[model samples]
Target: METVEFKGSHDPEKKIVVSLFWTVRKTIREEGCAPVHIKRIRTSRNVYEPEGRKLLKLSDDIMEDILRDMEMGNTVEFEMTMGTESLRVLIDDKRFSVEATRTPEIEKEIVEKLEHETSKLTPDFCQTFLPRIFPNQ
Candidate 1:
C-alpha cells in the first residue's frame, strides 16, 4: 500500500496524512484529506496540471494498472481511534436510538463537511502525491 500526503484536512497537524486506496468520497469525508484530486483542473492537451500547476499525466499502462488494482474491493482497514456515536429520539412516547453509522442524515452531513474541507486544499499537493502511486510511467 502507498501513502499519500493530503494537505486539506481539518487536522491541525502540520502535514495532513491521507490514504491512496480509499475512495475519493470516503477519504474526503472520513479522513478529511483534500479532494482536490481534479477540482480546479483546466486541460488543454492530454496532460494537465492541478490548481498548484504541477503537471501530471498517467500513462496508459499506469492507468490500466490502477483500474486493475481497484477491481478487488474492501481491502484496507483503519483502526477506529474515535469512538462511535449514538443518537436518540423520542416521538409521542416512542423512543428510538440510532447508531452513528445507521443514520443517513449524519452520513450526508459528514460528506458535506468533507467536501468543504477538501475544497480548502492547495492544488500544489495534488501532483506531489500522485506519482508515488503510479510510478515508472
Candidate 2:
C-alpha cells in the first residue's frame, strides 16, 4: 500500500484550514485517487472560550465519525463553533456540528494531505470541486 505521511508545524493562522485540507488529501491518496480540487473557507475570526473549548474537544472526538461517513463514498457535513462564532459545512446530506479549536499537530497532516490531493487536479476539475466543497460562501 502507498502510505503518504505528512509532517509540519501548526501555525495558528492557518491551522484549521491546513488540517481539514490534509484530511481530505490523505483520504484521497489512501483510496489511490485524487480530488479535483480542495477549497478552504475561513471564518472572519477565531472563537475561543471555556464552553467553546469543550465543544471543540467534542468535535475532535468525532473526527473518526466524520471520516467514516466520508469513506463510504458519501459527502459529510460539519458544523463548528467557537464561543458565539460558528460555521457549517455540508457535504451531500451528512451533517454534524461542534466548536472550533486550535490543534496544530493534527492540522499539519491535514494541510499537507489537502495540498497533495489538490495538486493532482486539473484546472477544470478544480472549477467544479471548489463550488461544491464550499457553497453559498
lDDT of each: 0.30, 0.33
Stretches of candidate 2 above 4 Å error?
A: 1-53, 58-61, 82-85, 91-117, 120-137
User: Per-residue lDDT for 30-103 in model 2, tens only?
Assistant: 33443222222222232222243222321332434444444453444444432332323333212212222333
lDDT of 1 by residue, 20-54 (tens): 22223333444354333321112121222333654
**Model 2 — which ten-residue stretch has the worst lDDT?**
91-100
After best superposition, candidate 2 residue 66: deviation in angstroms?
A: 1.5
- For model 1 the TM-score comes to 0.23
Clash count list over all predictions: 0, 5
Best by lDDT: 2
Local distance difference test, candidate 1: 0.30
After superposition on all CA atoms, how large is the RMSD of candidate 2?
15.8
Give per-model TM-scores.
0.23, 0.27
Lowest lDDT 10-mer window, candidate 1? 89-98
